[model samples]
Target: MSKTIFFVIAICWNISLIQAQFGFEFSDSIPVEIGNDQLKFPWSGGINHAQFSTIDYDFDGLNDLFIFDRSGNQIMLFKTIEENGDYTYKYIHNAASLFPEDLRYRVQLIDYNGDDKVDLFTYGIGGIKVYKNTGNLIDGLQWEVVKEVLKSEMPNGSFSNLFVSSVDIPALYDVDGDGDLDILTFNIGGQRIEYHKNTSVENYASTDSLIFKLENECWGKFIESDVSNSIDLNSNFGPCANNGLNIPEVTPRHSGSTVLAINLNNDNYLDLILGDVSHRNITALFNDTLHANPNAVMDSLDINFPSNTTPVDIPIFPANFYLDVNHDSIKDLIVTTNASGSSENKESVWYYKNNGTNEVPNFVFSEKGFLQNQMIENGKGALPVLVDLNNDGLKDLLIGTYFQYLDPADKISKIQCYLNTGTSSEPKFKFITDDWLSLSNSGYALRMHPTFGDLNNNAKQEMILGRADGLLSLYKKTGPGIQDYSLEEITLKDYMGEVIDVGQYASPQLFDITNNGRLDLVIGKKTAGLVYYENIGTKNQYSFKWVTDDLGAIDMGNIYQTDNYSTPHFVRHEDSLHLFVGNQIGNIHYFSNLDQDIIDDNPFVAASKNFANINTGGFSSPFVSQLTDDGRYHLFVGTDLGGLWAFVADKDSEPALKLTKQDTAEKQILVFPNPSKNGIINIKTPALKKLQLKVLNSLGQVIITKELNQPLNKIDLSTYRNGVYTLLFISDSGDFTSKKVIIK
Candidate 1:
């Protein structure tokens, strides 16, 4: 903690000015909770990649939903509860605590032992493991491991190939035409129906213990059908299956598949319904009642998804189920889909009602978020870019979610806006939308970084976005309002009109570094180096010339890329220019270019490698905001798991900390001025030798703990941020009282 490091940053759009003072020590605070956890963001945590299963778990005769969130690795139960003469699934987020603890994604619930009780089955490289249902409240709604379902040893995957059990869908069925239930599995990698027929007993009826042997490794005949007769190789990777009956039509599909066997046509045969991750769609194949059910005919299902939305390209898998949702004679189609939106992989349950006869089904779209109670997921990760889109004095939130560095077609760039409802000093937010600027799947940007500046000096700020491809694209503002943004994707060219690509992960920040009236571009890339592009042209008409790819010799390297890393935020403190850069390893590095020509290839002097001890786990992008109504600044950092943390600095002055350079605005909580004079506050308590004093921040994290043996004492909060904090007093008698203190 050096006096020279005592400078704070004030953000004005993409530009910043600061002098980190010593009076206030910045600490973490949580003003909002994502999901229903309290902050109540639009959705729960994660992408919500879920799988659906139907069963009468509550014994209500009505089917309930057994949802397996593959990403969350928890099995949630949606029970049918009768209420006010009507019945609906109990939407409580109570997940069944299975004994082996965390189950891997999918689980099959059925009468495995023919006990009429729903048993659980899970698969892995070790083969299918069975969990017998002891009773209705078996293990108090917890499924415990019972026995192994197979007798033969499954070959452990070699250096070249993966084992059968380690892959995708696994099912227990009678595909061998035998009285016993056999195993059928189909995966994306293999693209084949692997059959393991039950051989331990003549029947799988009421048998506590069971085992099976591998029968046909590829159960059906592989047919290289015409281009039009495909299952998963369509442009959208959908199962169009124009080919005739029963062959393994899914051989060409690249994404994984889900299969469920049931009597759909009531033809005394078990028909199969299929679902896939890429171009997630459900197709039906009515069995011809042959051995191994090889010759099944495909009549593509008329499934009407919510808003015509079908979840595609989930990180792991997507699934479907057949149940009589409305108690109709014909069964309906229920799918766990992450609908097409500005955001990606925001999964929810949807059902298509059966409108036709039992033999010939017609499914109509019903709901997108069917029977979902708590929707709190924002996405896989969150990256905050503070902007006031509404032209308010307050700083609004613009966060980019979906950090997986996959193909653009497979990635969804979810942009959310948490509109500031309260003033800039004491900000409260409401999630306005997840489709800000509608830049979702537009260019399929990975780890997208957005910076706003009036590059053309048109009063409105144009959005310059840097993506994983090391490219920069601008989304120019067209209308007066913040929501009036239409993306026009065009590659940014250098002075010679040559396209500029940084190799990968380009995080371009806009600011004037060469004392020019126009805004210049500084980019941080996957190599953890800074690239500078000087705007040589005027404000009205802009032309960017390549200045230097390596600015200040700043290089963080690729080793810190375990998380999304290296985003640079420029700050001007006192008479010197400073750069505060965040890295993949969750630390902010500071450097000074004092009185030096930054474009003259002079290397920046390192101020401190790890400044402020500010870490946000990983993928930490530090943002300084002029958020306080009184003028104090707050530091915000984005996390890998869709988290936005706030840090505030305690000040010594009564007035808000004066901004050395702030061109725009934003807002945290705490107060002590109401109960204090200057930085000292009087504490009144009963005289006790063993009385204890405790202080906590807004996040309920303890900050200070000490023994208070006096009735009245003075506590100095000048070194703390202005916000609501908790003060707890505990006596030796175990009596405790807590008070909310506002540090001013």
Candidate 2:
């Protein structure tokens, strides 16, 4: 009866028990911490709208972290350093800087010219800046500005929108099957995208004089007269004159516009995808090479034509990335929202299921499959990352967000994980509710993007999250998959600690049974029937003592053998205690404490009486409540068949009972050794009296009928063929239990 002894035994036994494979788990404590102290930066407003890129900048073969520090207006790198046995983050260098006053700079690293060396691209109010990697520096990698655009490249530089409007995150891709990568930047003010084609093809080493010209009429309204033989740049620089793709006025555009080029239809050609932070939907422009003519004049370029007149609308407006999350070979989209919406539409992550067909595939939305919004608070500026945190071959989602610094409300900022349960073809996921990794005081806010890599080449991926306070933290996957949790039983004395004994118990119920304004405990045991504990503790702590007098273990053996009694429910009627007893046989027996105190050794002698036989197969538990506004008590019974039955029981006498044969057949009757290899099967029932059990085959014929005298009855099925059979248990009281069994 000792809680400690029970806990120890339970833990020992459960060590070999296989847990039900569902739900996700995370670390209870942060294993690694990288804060302002290590970054040497006084926490300013944490990195907002932060972008990250992972690369082996130093040729170390290990992926290192890179981030654009918006607050400090500099690029920060967290180089991975290994000592003795621990991997730590070393503050390498602030690689480059944007216009220190302009904090909207977005950075991306890509091998722009396919030279194998990663190059840095940063865009802001100052215009697009490309930094060619000149190899790694001892403190950090060195960068040389290769191309700088401060004004519109259109003819005569007619429009100033390109230089004034905020440029979206540029997408790099080989748009025309050219070896060199091209740049596509969407101008929020111009309402168009500038496609900068890399003209220097063969020369890989030097980028000193790389010419990037504007491909006129690429995304704007076409002017047929300007297409004379070869394209002319004389009249191309007017209002909306660039070859950049124009943003449809119907489509919502904001400063947070993002562009991504991917082979959406599996067409082997890159398609354009656009998203805005405040938009309600995403737009996709399917690539159509049939309409494109690279050799045509500037105004005749086919890149502006879409297979479909209108863009393909996706549900997740602010999509972050299109990843093959299920490993299904096809890409799926991930989107997140902030708290500015309604309660039902609060900040949360969502995924669309890709129904395969490379050329314009359709995405299906799930009903119950999405992670609940409560898992992560309003993720306004936070981007969800898809990674295999546990290396379980399935991708898990990581969402990190926080409130503004020095906010009056003491809201805890943290990163939460939702592990994928389904496979690459069919994805099933659930959020880890209990084990959240708290980042208390780490920062007021986090950047939108987080990068993941095996920084130490340890086969496990580590996560680097940017904080608004200019500090970054790296979280290593400390354990395999999620944490495995199981309940353990301990000795009763150890569990009680200082509290006095109540009684031997099975199930307990906590409520103010005596209406003393303080909560009390009621427990029901197999042999003890029922016992009460008075609340004698203070506000800070709880202590209980056994009520040795009033309701001390009222024996329920007379009504039903005191074997499997459920948690007791107490209801007061006319200043009298109405006790309802539910046994394993689906019966609710009533007993009343009329005098409010036990006067005789056997309280059941005068109070015990039959109440309602709301036969709902075998009862698991029962409770009394006035479900309606009328002052009438209703007995609600929970059955072993996974159903709840309610019946009016205002009167003292038993209610009339009637149950259909089909209703009784639906209840679950215990059957064991089902796939009887030994040719023997056991059928158990809760009935104490003689019962008639019938076995039926697939056909409507009765195979066997035997009267069972004991609760445990066995039958021989050795001669029966391998198939499924039906079991029916009929008690002398006309109540029945039915189950299905298979014999192999």
Best by lDDT: 1
lDDT of 2 at 286: 46
Where model 2 places Cα greater than 4 Å from the true spot, the runs are: 1-52, 62-104, 137-140, 147-152, 157-164, 187-189, 202-210, 218-256, 266-269, 293-744
Candidate 2 per-residue C-alpha lDDT over 466-559 given as tens digits, one digit per residue, 9 for 90 to 100: 4343222335567675532111211222115542233322334445556554445555544545655665664333345566422634543545
lDDT tens per residue, model 1, 1-744: 111111122211111112232212444332443333434222222334455666666444666767665543545565666667675554432244222443664577776666666777766435566676654431123244565434542323212111334335555676645455666666333454555556645543534545554444444433212322134321112221322112233444453556666666556555665554444445555454553363333323333222234422233234567666665446777666422222224444566787776666566776664543233334554667777776777677788764432332555666777777676557766667767767665775656788888877778878888887888887878886868876665677776878888878777778777666788888887674688888889989777888777777776544525333578887554445667787666556666554475745787766555554444334557666667666555666664434455655445322332223322211111123343434466665443345577877544447778776555566776675544456665445333334555543
Give the C-alpha lDDT of model 2: 0.43
Top candidate (TM-score): 1
Clashes of 2: 24
TM-score (C-alpha, index-matched) for candidate 2: 0.34
Given candidate 1, what's the lDDT at residue 553?
74
TM-scores of all predicted structures: 0.50, 0.34
